[model samples]
Target: MESPATTKDTASRTQRPEGRPGYGQLLRTDGAWSFLLPGFLARQPYAMLTISIVLLVEHTTGSFGLAGAVSATAGIAMALLAPQSGKLADRFGQGAVLVPQVFLHALTIAALITVASTDAPLWSLFVAAVPAGATAPQISPMVRARWAARLQGSPLMTTAAAFESVTDEFTFVVGPVLATALCTGVHPAAGLIAEAAVSLVGGLIFAAQRRTQPASARAGDAPESARSDQARPQSALAVPGARVLVVAVLGIGMVFGGMQVSLTAFTESIGRPGINGLMYGAFAAGNMLAAVAVGAIRWKRGPQTRLLAGYPALVVAAALVAGTAQLDPWVLVLGALGTLTGLCIAPCMITSFTLIETLVPAGARTEAFTWLTGAIALGQATGSTVAGQLADRSGAGAGFLAPFAGTALALVVVLIFRKALHTPHSGLVAARGVGHRTTVTVD
Candidate 1:
């Protein structure tokens, strides 16, 4: 629901004063807060839905193997289809792309539950999830693209990216908990049902904010000025830093995927598998805090520099985990290390995203972001596979080596392409955003 204050702000249609606004001011802009909040409502359940499905299937069929397979199918679908959905949004528009897809996703949610309830067939669930995921709106990209388009040529662009990272981390933190609660507390299907409803409503509202949508590319490639900044002619993939960034994100994904496995393995090895959530929560908490702080403060350095710096921090942290694996009883120490590592993780992700925005052409923004995410998913799959294999061979604690190895590889990639990351636009973006205060009102 829109807060009364947000409604009032939108109704008034005020603009930010002469200077750049802080995170608080940017959100206070007319329709901005209301527009931004719904993406969370819509996207959080996506994180939750996989676990919900797994739990539901496992509980009903008493087969974790089948449940894992079903859930993996949904994830694979998302990874494969996200870029296509994003391209449609760029070619058509966000509303045209998101509204119908989100609706279909909701229906698929219902159909999957009903079909599964009848014990129709395990393959039925897989079939339903293909459409569910294919139709799933790329809400996360839409949110980032909206902010990028709306704040183009402004300093808050970087801050907006940072804030988006914080939102993602926070949502992951909350999403699983909510799903577990709904599935366990009510019924297995309750969580999926709730997710469907929210995605429907929230996506509708989010897509309605047409002013923030990236401007449509012109027909027959009209002259540049005829289109908005978002409709530039340059190929998005051809953008200077974009390909390297994709490679970097893949490595980052591997690091994250390995960490999840090792953390779970660590807990299980110590005979307290349930404590994994608490430790992961601590990790997310650090990411959230660091992202917020990074967004609020004015950065003297550009994101290219920050991206170069971030990978090494993650490498160190991952190594620390492997080194400390023998201290099985010291969960607190491990958690603290996780949190410290996350501080580096969030900043690296936020900066890379910001740097990419600076490099992507206006017409290809959505696809560019989606492709990066998909690459990360691919990398994560690699990390997960390797970690699981290592665990089977050498026990869970040794699984920590996966993240450390992945991050070390990533650090090398970032260092190799560090210079190309600097762009003419890089310095201007953050400078325009910081050391100034202004009341914001969205266009």
Candidate 2:
């Protein structure tokens, strides 16, 4: 099913020079820029959602606990539903799933903003959040799948994974800062309003880049062998070690969720609310820097070892951040600690994604990616909810504990499942062949 032109393109790029491909060379892939451009915009709304929700609902109800709870509801909904979205994208194509989903997402976000602004019942906020989160575009995972399609057999796959993580970090840098500035400077509702607009416009543009989208699985494309051997395509969760990775990512999400809410509360308590964005941007900048460094390295070891080595460092960083929040609530100390925390994050995330490429079948690549992302959302929701309550009762310092606890639990999970991370190379090759050439969409 590979086109002659596409085949030739891949063939030309497979031979590596002296070192690994640079980020510049990775972007030179034939159709990379088309999807990457729109994908950057499409992913921003996701980064904005947590901070935007926290600020808006807090303004509406005048309670951080309620704000965190409402944001958690949205995060939990997205986490539960994202895998299904990935499945639909896999089956029906990204455009088919993304176009309608974006419209619904925009509508839901508008309804949420209106409800919050009008001081609707607390229940109404939760109701609006479900569909809003559920319909949020799975652009990050979808874009990663496209990279796999283009660079599956090439060494650039590793670079692509690292670059995507860096891109994700960069959006976090921009999105929260932008949301905070809008909410504090312009209007409380401005951040959510901006999130809705970007999701609508950006999602449509990304969905329109059909040529770069990965192929969807079709009934006809199911090989006779696959049909006779199985009743349905295997779930990505069935892949060995995928669940462990999800648990690990959920822990990281907790750090994010806890940090955002706690940082906001901390700034407010200190009577300098506007500085929250700058501090969060500092955290994200560290993550972006680490991601770049991780990608640039040519590792002889596998992703599993990197994950094992990097995660404990994250736990230590999270603990240090918490200690700093409790002992010295100054902006400068917290900001420095936050950057250290961010530096620990990208390596684990980049390695987890790399493992997905090694472990999951081509048919379930997007779904597997979503599982990790959704875990993050779910974890973030949990962290926010817990930290919000803690901050309300004790102080911002108490909220900082959420991330430390989350990271500790995640380290335990990773250490326990350490052995399962390995898979036979032959099995991976066999699994990847299931539907390699099935095109999901076309220009």
Best by lDDT: 2
Question: lDDT for model 1, on a 0 to 1 scale?
Answer: 0.69
**Full-model lDDT, candidate 2:** 0.83
Where does candidate 1 stray beyond 4 Å? Answer: 1-14, 50-73, 107-129, 145-159, 180-194, 205-233, 261-274, 360-366, 392-394, 424-443
What lDDT does candidate 1 reach at residue 400?
70
Cα deviation at 141, candidate 2, in Å, is: 2.0
* Candidate 2 per-residue C-alpha lDDT over 397-426 given as tens digits, one digit per residue, 9 for 90 to 100: 888999999999989988998877775453
* Model 2 TM-score on a 0 to 1 scale: 0.88
Off by over 4 Å in 2: 1-6, 12-20, 151-155, 218-232, 360-364, 424-443
The C-alpha TM-scores of every prediction are 0.77, 0.88
Candidate 1 structure, TM-score to reference: 0.77
